[model samples]
Target chain A: MFDRETITNDRDPLRAQFQGMKGKLCASPELKAALITGTPLHTPAVGKRVHIRRFSKAIAVYAMCALLLLGTAIALPSLLKGMDPTSASSSTGDHDCIPPAVAMSSPSQLYERLLSEPNVVYREVGTIYFQDGSVKTSHVTEMTRRGDLFTTLNYGDGEPEHVRYYDVGGDKPCVYYNRNDLWFTSELRGDNATWAHWCKAYMAVNWLEDEHYEKTADGYKFTEEFIAEQIEEFKCEDAEGTLTFQDGVYTLRVVRHKEQFREEPCESVFEIQISFGNAPEIVLPEATICTHEYEVEVIPSDHPCRYGDETRYTCKICNDWYNEWSPTVPHNIVDGICTGCKLSEEEIGNLPDDDPDNEDHSDIIYGPYVEMSISRPSMQEFLEFYTVFQRKNTAPIVVTDLGDQKNSITQYHFYGGIINKNTFPDDYDYDYSSGEIRVPIQFWYSFYYNCDDAYFGTYDYGIVAENYTLDNDAVIDLDNIRLERVSTGMETFSAKHELSAKGKKEGEIRYYEIYSGENRLMKFAICAVASTEDSYYDSICQQVVDGLVKLG
Target chain B: MKDPQDDRAQIVENYADMVWRIALSRTRREEAAEEVVQEVFLSLFQKERTFNEEEHLKAWLIRTTLICCKHYLTASFRNATISLDEVGDLPAMSEGQSTVYEALLSLPAKYRIPLQLYYIEEMDSDACAKAMGLRPGTFRVRLNRGRNLLRELLKGEGIDV
Candidate 1:
């Protein structure tokens, strides 16, 4: 009935073009040579999304053997007293490669970075997933981003919601939004209303819990409690969220909160797609009730022991008012016992112990430890020293900051005073013997994604995987590491090692030689931005800790 | 004495064009297509895969090309490159009459990919669907839509389809 040659007849419009394209394009010389040589013609590119070549049987064997060998060397438990950030001594790690300006970031850092983008869009798709594997997608909240300057259209749902934008025309950083004429503006220009509002709207997850410093081989995976009260419609309770970070960024986050006290269980789920598409402009409607005059009702703050005096001002009419997280009230210490919460001085001393894995604090601030302000780099400086850029305060993986530096090779910074099972020994039901890492194996899995996200947030370039990795002795002398730039560069990270991990992380493949007496294990991570496969000069990635790790 | 035949080199030579064309259809830029081809073959050479059948190898190449295309065209990649540099924009190209190539290029990406694989590579609907990660029924629907769209595009240009 049909033949190949006859089917490619002139009757088909594509016949001529296909043949033309075929003639013009051919295999390049490098490709042919690489095929013959069995070497890669081009190094694989990194950033956004990456596909892992499934390890073969032989390679898997070799990898297992290597992990076994590595296990012996890295297993020696190391200890470091963590800096409480408010009071107590600075427990800055003895990291030698600490950048001058940037601090290492936490998983929360990704949200901060995404929210900071001017031209970004996030579609918070809420789906109610049941234990039976059925799902009911209820609502979608689409937030439009335009960096600090881009105009945003809040709708890809056919119906455009009221657009929000920043206006330099009026005054300070002001966000104007109107939903069907009920217009309002944020006090972000004068106060911290903008940041506080962003905190409430998105990125409400507090990563300062006990989950930090833990390790996930492929990506960073962490779990935290999901407040059931946040969702009124779903009526969910005892919610817990498991977030999976494939590379350095979280690709999937599944939050499971059950409907209140039901024998048959269900969970609430939401997937946020960080859209890079340009925001279409919409004319703002005439403002009717833009400003809200709240009847000032002062809710007495909670004790410094819990929630630090929860004081909030909500407008009498609408949900509009100034919100702030005031510092913890001074503890009334009389004869070594806190009069307010009855916590003893000796008990507080025992809080900061030898365990180097987690910070025992949750939502509680101890003493007068204020969030110290650090200087961030200028925009021009940030762009200049991006990927593969030179760093100023480079150091050997040696004991430079040996003076009282906490050698706790950890991935998390635990804030003190949180009344958790570990923080308060009052919970007899708590198991102290479970999941304690006294000798934490320190490694740096900083994602120096100075490179662009797949135009937006949908793609996962596997480069984010093994690309930015550091496998070394857990402790680094961090006191000398200064903060110079806050941008995500591979260098310039300071104690601000913990803007919640270090200064702007970059992608230069920096090596830290680890010494175990006779044997030397070199741990170095290459930035996906700096060491893109296109930048073929970064042959050191071949010595990736996850892949073909070169050992001597 | 002749050296052992390099299977990798022979394989690359065989499929580089198909992979590049499929990538070109998706990405539209020569550079992006070339880069995608490189990644596909490099992935092939690096993996310790044993392809028993010729169709299986072809399927792998097609699948890989599709994946690379999905990852290749991000905002970061666009910003990283100087320009898209489409084939039509080259100085030597003729102008005036809209060629079948231009008409085909004008279609949406979803249709263009299936059209190229089904018509250009002469792949059946089932094989094309499998490669594109689509159901056989869905693939048939897309193929019809593509044909209709192409026919309309050509008819508008005063060409018989």
Candidate 2:
């Protein structure tokens, strides 16, 4: 039994110490300085680990609705061009590859069909040896009843191995059966490595058919035969370039002029080859090994990349490396804690001159990081200013450091690419179509350094959501925006907008307009350095556009 | 009836002492406890459009304050990135010893939150149960356990209740 009165009689004596913390918090020298100076204080959102928490229900609903509509709009042209799943383009003499009359079904139904009926009879047998001195065998088979959709399997003799189904326009290895046409799919599985690794290889091989893209800017025009030749010619040894072996890693630098790099005109162009082990499997794609003009500095992490660990953290940029996406050396901090990394061009130029032991360094870059670069349009500009942050530009998002102690680091992440929904043909397979307006969002933040204390990254606060309606239709005419100093009587803030474009190669800027409590204007000016477009991806961008439309 | 956003901001400005006191009672550490108050007010500001009236927003703030305080206790164990080594440098008062305060700091997260909500927050046991997201019977059990632990800790330090 407990003494009820005694138990209930607890109180906090330190209550008096915090009599006015809220008011004081607003007036604190640190927050006040940040509010006025506009210089970020601590690990600014810019280079921090991109921790996108689940959106609130209202926001999620608003965004999803917009995206769904956008997807439908962008997809209509391509969908119309799709002549019954099995039919080929009437204009081209090429064989009608798309299957028709494919009965569309839910993913669950497809899974059940593969499981119960053995209807998806994939039967290509292969053996794989595991690193742990073990061997396993696999067989793959396919079945397409209505022609377009194909249910497929890659399994052991009788057991259900990794199974999948593909709608006609699905991405590679996912299978693309012509709707009403006869299509065949092959499957292979072996314990050569893990299931995931083997699956990656199989998918890569089967989806190896050359894809022909009409010449756009820096694009490739490939056919099945050309792709097969490229695949056959591919040898870790005969990569046709200079091989620099460093730290157990081998790198081949392949050069290509801006124009010759692809079908479309290329502005930023460079190519290279890199390999690690004796296995040709270690070879990376041409895009992976290429180096660009900027430098990237990956924040060092004390935690080595390992399984089950959430390796989500941020890195700092030294400000001076602003506006350049460069290669990075992943590292850890002094506290034995792992965060993000900064990327820089300088780091790539000074790679530890070729060493055989650099095998670990050659591992492929994954996960998300920021890419920072500065661009002054260098020409006269025009209307509603907007900032467009891109997730990827051939090379993914990279971060650079501004040596300025105030805003030490920032990042530009490869947000993913945007398609001109207007330009995308209706017949193209599963594509994200959209009008010219786009917003590929990215994060930017900085830390307020304390010499007496150790702080791993910069810290500043800002909004994180799919999209925000501009006060005015200010995005189209990007020239109206410019960076300037902002005064709020007691504080100051610096403003800037960032922009990125692919087709027309135009720029946009973003700025903040401050209004007083009395509805009187306090500050109004164009700003720069931080923005993204809504046109980055089909599935996701469509929603942002919808959000904008809903707001409208 | 002023704008709800402005009204809620006023409640935060006016009742901040009440919120911070409850937070300090639970967290014991001042900076983190202060952060809890800031989060509560910031949340009120961000969600200003949702509340029906001023009082409703106040209640939400108070509830959020308790949750934030409880979160601080659990968060402290896993995210002890900020070192507590310097906490000893602060000077002690010449009046009564702050043994109970120290004792509360030593208690586990589950016990600390229940005791603070009931005693320092001035909420009834049922309200405490609601705020902590627990059943009334469970809330009573937690209170007993917390009170016993505090007594024992203070007893060890030669402090009479």
Candidate 3:
């Protein structure tokens, strides 16, 4: 009777026979030649041939005339206009001295003219005073065209605090942070809408119909008032503005009032100046554009061709392909040559009245047999090989320092009958009640394979604490760290440290440090603390220490 | 750095035996097994694939071999009448062991392939499940059912297994 043990444990003679067959098949001379020459014994059927006979003489002449016409159509415009005068003049002085096309009479007229113009430059300054005595000021220099807009705004000093660019008619505008090489896109409304409105208002004389108009010595002067009813649409309580146009320049002054709460009144004043012609060029720092390109190369079969060898094909990106091989009928071999093909063996056993349909067929035996060792482990063996000691609690405990510039504080968690938070006297305050470890630490139960073919199950956890200082007088010994430096052959010093405490519940901690020169780059610690003298905890801890992988 | 061509050759050499074993377990014919192994290796060689470890490579080969075996079986020109007797002879074994081998081969391809990977290849149930694209629990159920079927077949043949 075959039990589960026998089925799982018994060595199958078939496996050995098959393995021997594989060795013989791979060592075949035909396969070796095919692999080296990169050629198939049977040529693949060619796809339907696309035959294009020679073009007729009349058709060829017609195609030539069409090509000539296309060339003439492309060249006609450039030939008639010659070289552009503006492009030919390379001097910046000559370009800047170009006169304005016409004088703009009104704000609306100026805005209409500027919309058609390529570049328009202007500056706007706005200051707001709140009831709480808080003040915010924004000074901006900007340039704009039909679909393009660029602006630099300063909140405090003359230096730009924020720089933004918007291709107005297209996608989202990308704002660039100069301090950090950070760029992000946001929606077209909110602050961006306000900037767009300011730029349009600078060129136009009567963006909003004026409440009062007066003729000044230099140019036309106009004033407009937005009451509480109309202010909501403009995102303000009430607003009053006056605009003056003089000699291709427009000056605007606006005051806005808002009451955020019942008693908190806020007021803002804006001064804007717009000048026609000669807008400075907008230059942007280079940035990488994220894209992907797929490159494919076909790889032929690596092995030589056998009696039945499939066509090998490959695409270099993801491992996906179509494979086909010729099928061959099994044939009997006598003296290393196929007897089925020769018909010699059948002729020797000839019976005059033998019917081919009723004849019995026997299996063909192939040559050059090799010994195969097939000893499969039983179920019990598998269990023993895969079993290992693993900790129940895989949650990570993190120690952090929170103190003044020089003060150092270390945190620890000790669990023995109940959870206890231990706080020592130090200059820094420690809070562990949150139960959430803020540092980048991850923990999970995982299986580990040992050298003895046994699995040592472990509570896998990793710590990522960067540039942490260990005070000399701290409870944990700082100088007694047993460090083993690993040469990664890079500019960083990678090391592992093992430290253990013998008193009370035996605790073991494994610390890994990565340093660049004298500066400590990163420090990670994996600790296993137990209250009792349990060997399982120690074994699991040891396994975890051995399985530590340094991430660069 | 290893040249791409050399790396491909090494991959083919190292995993050819395993791929053939898997293919043979499914098709049960030497020619079909050879065809499936060639198809699987050629498919792997043609693509740009990155394996994380040896386990991943073996798993990919096993999975691809099974897929190729399926494709070969479904081909219009496939000779379904090709019996085990026509292919080759097994190494001499006792009557009971021989019966067990026949019973195992008689099981459906889905159940037999997993059993072969688990018992013959010595892969863990998890690895077998991954290669066969089955959940661990589902694979265990299928394996148990397959063993029961084999046991019944052996009993019918008047040999307890």
Candidate 4:
């Protein structure tokens, strides 16, 4: 079983640590009083109370409602007349809201009545059945006033193929391209205008000439046919249409038996059903309007004309440019340089032979190479020496030496501070070649809770680098070094060792060494009393070593 | 007679630890956890609400702490960049305990909150589901997944738990 006990027990220590924090977290007395009283501690002049105080102004709303009710009753009939579905205009009271008892005599009268209704929506579904028995379905939705807000969703094989929204109320009508996710506006009024113009031009018909009218149980019906010459002009063998009106809606359908054009047998059908009602509210996205305005001017090329080059012209308005290529002589190269618009060598010699003594000699060298030796270490070598002392400390475990600010070495003094208040012997030397820095420090650890008798010792604490090349001269013993993987935003290994120095006892001095890479090694050593129990100093030393980061 | 201010204080005193732990587990930042704790308690102070039982109060605190932690993480003005050194000083824990805490902190938020509520708060799967506004089945699945991920992460760090 997975150990859930570990996670449950992990918070025990933290809970104990936070046990008494509630006393420190109590709200102030003033805050507690404000909370109990439900009053704002810092009240603003413009506040919620001010808004509540203004509700007394609502008494006039009832009087306004009574006036509106009286006005509505007086204008109710004209309002009903204006909203009548069958009439084109309120002034024309010829058509009733209900279908007339007398049948409409012609298809023209039906079409005129259907087109005249305001706020009407229609959906037309047409299926084209090919001679080969394949079928294709198409759908179109039309609305009069709010047609701009209508969306037509077309389905193919029981799945949505595309959606199109029309906005006709704007200055120009537009079709929203669902696939492109954009609206495309047209200069024409709308689809209805285009269809009306096409019908008038190609399929001109006189509904009265057909003289076919019937009154069905539902409503009236009318049928009309185009002339033979008009049918021929429309590329169809026959063209006919039917119109019906019932329940405040009109249905118009047209069928054209197309003559075989391009050796394909097909018939085209169009149907429109119109109903009058208030259009549904449609939310439209803010659309980007297309605008075009640019001032065009010819700008000549700023560069001088070269041989075999072309002249270029740019528009100052939009920086659009074009180049006109023309034939020209190529430039000649003399002494690995272009000689275009340059004087000959004889002309150059005639201009400059006046001052022989004043010639520039800065580029000429005066002496051969000389060698000198200085004992100061390079910046990289100096930082390596400095990092050894920094790695020995428990705090500021990570030190970044950015090197000298301005080509001079930055010297840092260690160990001779007021805290320690001790002077080192004159013979105490730092081994810079091996990257070693040794400082004498006192360290102590207690094992058995006897503060007075705790182990106190002094020893030389230092850091050393052991460079191991690929040739195995100085290999670390894997068995002897206790490795702990540490991450300082970069992975490295820390080696812990308990060893006896020249004067300290074995297992009394602790050493922590971090291996940066194959070449550089940083070590921290402290003298302490080591027992079988885990030493807190070891963890602290490990933390310091883990913080080591190379900033070179 | 007991006043509402005393009731609010009693609630804060009782549930502050659980709320702080949940916030710390979710945010993985001590300062952010402290801020979430303050926000949760301040909301409880401002709103006059009644709970059916002590369990309901605990659930409300956990839920509010999770929300506050999420808000702190996603607030536009919150600093997005925090260095590893800034997160170095965790509340003192044993080395092994620190390893477990790191493994828990490394988990994704969805799994971390449910795991902390279930294991640390000793809330059952149903209670945890109610606190997180999740179905019992979904909470169980997340708990199991979170446990497995934590086990793998601890194993990678050479910790058995």
Candidate 5:
């Protein structure tokens, strides 16, 4: 391998050799022949511009003539008459005064004369589609002409995208995009355009006339009189000129007007400001006649828009065509139906009554909570908060017990009560007339948790632990609880459930106490919704936990 | 008002060698190279666009020679680069030229082009980089790899490193 060091070392020497080689090649006779005859030729110097084979005889004859001319001075004047004007001319002053006239070939006159008679192909036009799904047909009324690269696109019921390749010569070909209001270069070279113009003009002028125009009802339907009349009413303003020189060819064309006609509205032409060499003039050629028929078929036939389930009010006319649950209105469709609802509870063994003074209520801090609170501190307050919490957090909040994954906390929902605007339980704190309750802060470190998919829904819940209430007015702190963002767009505090439980479940209560053990762990995950509106409640709940919950 | 003599002299001095080399490189036919070299220079003389320097002169010669080669080999030229690679591997005499120069003759265009610009043309990394449209750093890497591959044949023939 030629590594960097070797390559760098060789660079100077190699360049020196290259220079040497160039000199040798330049001096080599083979190279000289290659330069001149493009092949090695064994011959003496021949006259410059003399073809290799034309040498021997031609030079011999020329030398003999020169010798003869030197011998005869009297005949020399007549022999050299056309040869050297320099020696015979009396004065050099006459040469400086008059310049020879240059002959100009007028292709434009040839074009005009060629176009004076109707081009046979003009009777037969070809149709092409425009951007807006309307079609226009163009006819070659004259020889395609050397300069015009005009093509038409139908714009709606009129002209929309108008393009003309003008000044189509030179290295950079110029094209005019009228509708876009810009003129720029086309990628093709000018010579290519000239050759193409030659071919098209030849075809347009020479192709046998197909009276196909008369055969079609719409063909050539707008006669010269109608086009002239339309041109009279049209506006010609904001015209621009374009010029180009390329590939031994030069062209200049000016655009005078772009207008729609009053009577035959779709018939429009670029009123061209024409210039061949010196003079500039105007010509109105009917190029594009925009049609309305093609626009209606632009959209696919089976599209929902065609079936009348459109966003616009116009689609409502076809409302009877579909059901209220139609996917056309995305909001009405949902993943699964809410089939059943209920409340149940299982308790840890009852707590013995203790003195309020030594109870240490300092451990619980309830909220930055929102929603209705009936803080009457009745026996019912503890029952309702416990019930609602369980209904909301069905997914057990996992907590780390030991360092191992196996030793994790899981909640078993034995029983809890749920009450809402529609269903309110008796013996609940405030009747349906008074709404949901609030609890304050708590946070902790915990292991990750996953809810059983069968039990998780758009709304699901979990319970931490409960407290006995002195009355409905007693405030509870929620400082030790752990919950994760299950799904967003949850109507957070909207539902209130009040439960009255006369429960004794031996093992169930023990499990609740085990979950509430001093080492109960907590973790959090952010739940995001697709739409911005849906993320609000989830953001608030996450913030509330952060502000109020703390772990030691 | 230009004299034909001056134009012919200018074309010969400027483009004759470049046109010959491009045609020879492209067609691999000496006769074709001869034909193309003459035609290309003649055409340059006839064409109106004026060339002022070596770079413009070279570009015109290369472009014209390429067009002629494309016309001559229009059939097999479609995959001519592959043929070029096959030819680039031939042996060379100890005179600092390798058959790889011939093999370079065989080298497919993809390989042959970079090789020529690097070695034969004496174009440094940056110039080769511009010609190949590759970044200089990339051209350096490609040149190293291509040289190493060409070096394989030399190693087998007992050529000293």
Candidate 6:
């Protein structure tokens, strides 16, 4: 048999080969950047723009010769005409004096038309979310292009806020970030110059009418959703734009989402603001994500029976808000029926509670220590529960010596009298008045009838353990919490109990502990379910122990 | 709330490679493996949940990686073409190691996974079985059978384990 040492020894091939797996598979920083920032990495070389030819080569070649003959005749006349009045002929750079009002894609003949366009500044106001639609480490990116100089400031939380300079013109924009590594260049290449995403977005959008519209008194209002497929300069799996014309003004909003690691589209979209050329000396904002200094209000559900509360968190700064669903309030149970939910614990266990008189009494069957039942519980006598549980109950009634696991030829009753090491006498003649029960902290109870299956069934319980008087119904911490109904909400306290009690035993042992701040006593009424076949009895015993009101 | 970047770094450090390996094994494509790892981590970081044990976290990554692998294979929009070179990582040739590695890859995953997990990953047989969704005894039998086949394959290659 091959062992760990045999397989993993330094001399071995398996271990040696795998030792370099990390090196070969070492994750790229771009991958980490993509994962962290949610950027797409699929930068296919901006594919050549396909042009559909209108005419075939044969016809075009024949027509070209005729046009050239006519053009040469006109040129001779024009040259002669110009020579007679020749002073000096000159031309200027083809750049237009004005920059485009909208920026996404610039004209392809940039060399001809770019020089005249004035320096442009792009500032993204408000919040900038990452690919995961999270504002964590959010920063603003400001780009300004003047002549051949394009400066970008990407400053904020997740990464070090730094100002980078790029010499832009012609090719890709290359940036050198760190002072130490002077030669290292950034992916901030000429292909992905600061304005490229905007340019790509502008060029790629094929605006389609949105199916959804808001009905208005005049007629209807609709927005156009622009869709962009794979474009090389952009890394996103897709980019979408919403263009809406309202009144006399037009607005465009673009959103991009992708994880470079997967090179796939994701649901988390980042909404960025793009405005062209109004070069204001750009400055950073006070908050990358909203400060959310505004107060939040949580309104409880009107249907408390089923739905929990709906809460709204609003930001005073941005008026940006989100909502959340809180869990339903604990079911309101009265006499085994909830006034709030109108369902009893038995009904929740699944059946309607038609019998008004048949109120559940878990304390009766599972001993007085347990205050309530979470799952439906049925128990009659201790011996009956012990038999099926495979545990011999070593209650004081059975074992003379305390803390003993197996009590021979004997049986036990469930008795929890913590604070006193000694167990109550076999015939203590106890009533359901004053009982003190705290588990495993000071006392241990091992009651067994038989074996294996029983040990597996014990589940731990935690509680506040404050002095609380038990009533016919359950409530806790007594006078501190004056609610009439049982509360399942447990506070964190380092107390736990797993009743590793075993087998079929059904018997009543009652003494309801009373501590209403000052040790007062009250007896709880008993409710017993009938026991039948051994399996039937064991199943009920399991529920009794199982139900022990799962505290947390 | 916890700092998101710190949380991301911690989760990536803890499970990135484990996820990468599982994804690589299931998808059998380098590109698909990277995609699966990214998707799994994205889903993990996006959702809000807590695990009491690192074991539970690992189990979740395994399950999620398998699901991601399935999605990658079955996605209607996927256009990626498979390349033989991208299928798996190659080990350095030393002694009969490369031969052994090739044989291991040739075996069916059901048998291969048990051996790899137990021997290569140093996971116990019980954990290997649980991960493979098989009973402990079944996993042990497969391991033994897989070992025997590997030896036979190696012998045929003029080498002995």
Best candidate according to TM-score? 1
| Model 2 TM-score relative to the real fold | 0.26
On residues A1-552, what C-alpha lDDT tens digit does candidate 4 reach at each position? 765545554643333422333333233345334434444444312211121111111111111111122222232222212222332222222211222222221112211222343244333222222112333333222222232343344433344433444443454333342322212221222223322222221111112111222235743333322222222233323445554456744444445443211123334445444322233236644432211111112222222211111122222211222221100111122222222111212122322322335555343221211111111222222221122121111211112221222111222122210001121212132332332222322111111111222221111223222331212122222223232221111111122323221222224334444332222223333332122122453353333323322222
Give the residue spans of candidate 4 off by over 4 A: A1-552, B82-88
DockQ of 2: 0.02
Fnat of each candidate: 0.20, 0.00, 0.00, 0.01, 0.03, 0.05
How do the residues A1-552 of candidate 6 rate in per-residue lDDT, one tens digit apiece?
A: 877644445444444434434333444566666666655443211101000011111112212222121222222222112221111112122221122222212111111112233354444221222122322222344444455554444443334344444443454333323211112222222222223222222221111112222235743333221111111113223344554354522243444443222223333322222211112333433322211111112122221111011122222211222221111111222222222222111213233434435554322322212111110011111011111111112211111111111111112222222222232222122222334222211111111111200111111121122353343222222212111111121111111112222222235311122222221211111112233344543354344433321210
**Full-model lDDT for every candidate:** 0.35, 0.31, 0.35, 0.35, 0.29, 0.34
Better of 1 and 6 by DockQ: 1
iRMS for all predictions? 16.2, 18.1, 23.7, 28.9, 25.5, 13.1
Residue lDDT tens for model 3, A9-80: 455433342232323323233433333334443331111100000111111122222222222223222211
Candidate 6, position A539, lDDT = 50
Question: What local lDDT score does residue A277 receive in model 6, on the 0 to 100 scale?
Answer: 17
TM-score of each: 0.32, 0.26, 0.27, 0.26, 0.25, 0.28
- Candidate 2 residue spans exceeding 4 A from truth: A1-552, B1-9, B25-28, B49-58, B66-97
Number of backbone clashes in candidate 5: 61
Which of the CAPRI classes, incorrect, acceptable, medium or high, describes model 4? incorrect
- Looking at chain B only, the TM-scores across the models are 0.85, 0.72, 0.83, 0.89, 0.65, 0.78
- Residue-wise C-alpha lDDT for candidate 5, range B76-155, written one tens digit per residue: 32133222333232222435454334544543344445565555555556655654444455567556655654555445
Model 3 CA lDDT for position A467: 29
